[model samples]
Target: MRRLPLAILAIALLVAGCDDAGASPAAQGSTAPAASAGGACQLLDFGMVNAKLGLDLSVAAGASLDNTFTCVLQAKGVSYPDLVLAVSSTTIDADVFGDMIQPKNATAVQGLGVAGYQMPTPAAGKAGPGVEVGWLAGNKRIIELSLRFAPGTPDQRAADAVPKVVELAKLIDLSSL
Candidate 1:
């Protein structure tokens, strides 16, 4: 439970420390702590996300570090409605996907990757209501997308984010990362 969030924070910090010079928002850079970091941002562009999530947004930043790639997308010139993506190395087995990878409240999802889960993110502090979709990709990799709405967004719209997040998750190609 607590392990997942800590792992994500560590990955994010590692990504932030890497250099992304000359890398366009779409490229996600080739620099990494180890190995050639592939084009992770290409997995889902703004158009793909906007079409599925019904929001106009742009890539704020993207970079890859170690075995993880991180991308952040958001509405132009605003911080609200931030969508963060992470594709990273994984060790979890599919057999324990539910019991180990996801919390008790998470819903099991299929077809997105080797195994998948979706869960609602409750608002806390400066963060707003959101939805998270996570899936296991090939080569022991996992992808997690967290989409957080504006704090004042209506309850229905926040609830609606669940399906949208799942749809956005499907756009990611498991073989690419």
Candidate 2:
């Protein structure tokens, strides 16, 4: 039985090797099936500190059937004065996803603020920096990307991540999604 399994594994490896040799150069270079419009938005490395977040790309329902990509990042135990690198485009916008982030050291809650449908406060906990990119869909269905790291203080990380995120966002091609 052991010998039979070994033989099967060997055969499988040989078949996989043959398939690779038959694949075209384009097939190896491009992972996606077809070319997308927005181009390709590559995910770069961003060093953040104790950060957690989500990236989602989905097809919008109704009307034109647009595609949207949202990136959210949150971190704890961050110091003061942070920077964030984010992506930028007319269709891309960055903002506080939920309620204002009341760090460990908060003075007071002055006033209420507008809330988004996907992000409601109270249960939402403290708000984190978020970037959203969207565009009309053509050949692609969805494109999602994210980068997380423990850079340091929240303020500093946010500031640094902003520009980087914007640059990254511009690289994203909605047509591929």
Instruction: Compare the candidates by lDDT and give the number of the best one.
Output: 1
Off by over 4 Å in 1: 5-7, 10-39, 174-177
- CA RMSD of each candidate after superposition: 5.5, 18.0
Off by over 4 Å in 2: 1-138, 174-177
**TM-score per candidate, chains pooled:** 0.77, 0.24
Against the correct fold, how does model 1 do in TM-score?
0.77
- Highest TM-score: give the candidate number: 1
Error of 1 at 26 (Å): 8.2
Position 134, candidate 2: lDDT = 24
Query: Model 1: which ten-residue window has the lowest total lDDT?
Result: 28-37
- Expressed as tens digits, the lDDT of each residue in 1-177 for candidate 1 is 533664487445633443334323332331221112233554656666777888766535666666677766655446668777787776887766656776677888877787888988888666678888887776577788888787776657768889888887876744355
- Candidate 2's error at 42, in angstroms? 8.6
- Of candidate 2, the 10-residue stretch with the lowest lDDT total is 57-66
